[model samples]
Target: MKKIKIYLDYKCFPIWIYNDKGELIGNDLPKELADDKQADEVFVKIQNIYDNLFINDLIEFKYIGFSSEIDREGYLKMIDDAVKLLKIKLGDLYVIEEKIEV
Candidate 1:
């Protein structure tokens, strides 16, 4: 299992996640606002379990509106595009990308 390394700009509001191979897996908003409190805790758990996610294995992350304002729908779409890019570039090794402003 390969864990992905990802950096989240507190300013961006979508959850960003990566695998060990440095690939974007999944990004989306939380189920609700109240869930924000538990975002870090849940993320830690996710990391603990998926510390090393294999290639092709989806690793989803969220960019909550915590540190800054971000486009919810756009971020999600970015995640989708990132995943596709990873599949194409890494194929089944690893995928990772930097957060960009759209």
Candidate 2:
């Protein structure tokens, strides 16, 4: 199987679009490597999985507001859930590895 490594440093933000002074294009990689339209479609689903991670921000706010603290377990669970979902989506297509920065 191939490999898909996700870094935790991007704040779980999904940046699939590339915009510059004037030019706008879809960021490449998973899409570029996707050789067929079907593959691109699958990647779109995968992109959504990553995109949803952005919600963690709001969740974090809720946690802090309710408890005045950061719930480490919940925080880590969010990441773990994302990883599991990624693996399910990827199936055998690629190996999923998450990189966390300390």
Candidate 3:
């Protein structure tokens, strides 16, 4: 049987805008910002920072799998070695297995 293993990381960022009464506002914020010029300017600056720091920059990894006729123990040892060498935590590791119908 042939199998494949996959690993990935999921990330999320939340943006929040609030009104005077602490009411949450949606994405159409420019209209709301019209009421406060100073706030609007600050908001634009913060938004630019967010775009440059978070939106434009994201972490990613590329891994290539090689096929070998090793036993299950050997496969597991290889995975363990990779995780240790890469300094990856158990919580951040993900694995997907696929069977090749050949």
Candidate 4:
């Protein structure tokens, strides 16, 4: 299986987007969020959007990007769901994007 790499922008923090192989994917910065709660709301909304898309089997994602606007839990759920769905479709032989530490 092939691996893909996703790089996050410096401005985004906390939430780290990733591809199936654990490569950083995209930045999810919800613009105009008034506060943390609002930010979380936006994340939930985004997740809902993604979830609906996934339910319809419309999205086949090799990578997903998220900005700092998404909290830790939110980011985790998104990544988990993304990978789970991808794996379900691609099977176990799929390769993930990541690096090995020496």
On a 0 to 100 scale, what is the lDDT of residue 24 in model 1? 57
Residue 31, candidate 1: how far off, in angstroms?
A: 34
Ranking by TM-score: 2, 4, 1, 3
TM-score of each prediction = 0.30, 0.41, 0.26, 0.30
True-structure RMSD, every candidate: 15.8, 9.5, 19.4, 16.0
Tell me the whole-model lDDT of each prediction, alpha carbons only. 0.41, 0.45, 0.34, 0.40
Tell me the tens digit of each residue's lDDT in model 2 across 29-95.
Answer: 3543446454444445444444444435534622112132254455455566656655565566555
Q: lDDT score, residue 84, model 4?
A: 48
* Clashing residue pairs for model 3: none
User: What's model 2's TM-score?
Assistant: 0.41
Candidate 4 lDDT by residue in tens digits, 22-100: 6655444222222446445544554454443222336643334333445545655655554444345445444433221
lDDT, candidate 3, 24-68, per-residue tens? 443322242346554444434433333333223356433323244
* Per-model tally of clashing residue pairs: 18, 0, 0, 9
Relative to the unseen true structure, what is the C-alpha lDDT of residue 21 in candidate 4, on a scale of 0 to 100?
61
* Error of model 4, residue 33, in angstroms: 32
Between candidates 3 and 4, name the one with more favorable TM-score: 4
In TM-score terms, which candidate is top? 2
Candidate 1 lDDT, 1-102, residue by residue in tens = 332334444333345545455565545422332344444444444333232222332675443242223544544454556445444544544433444332
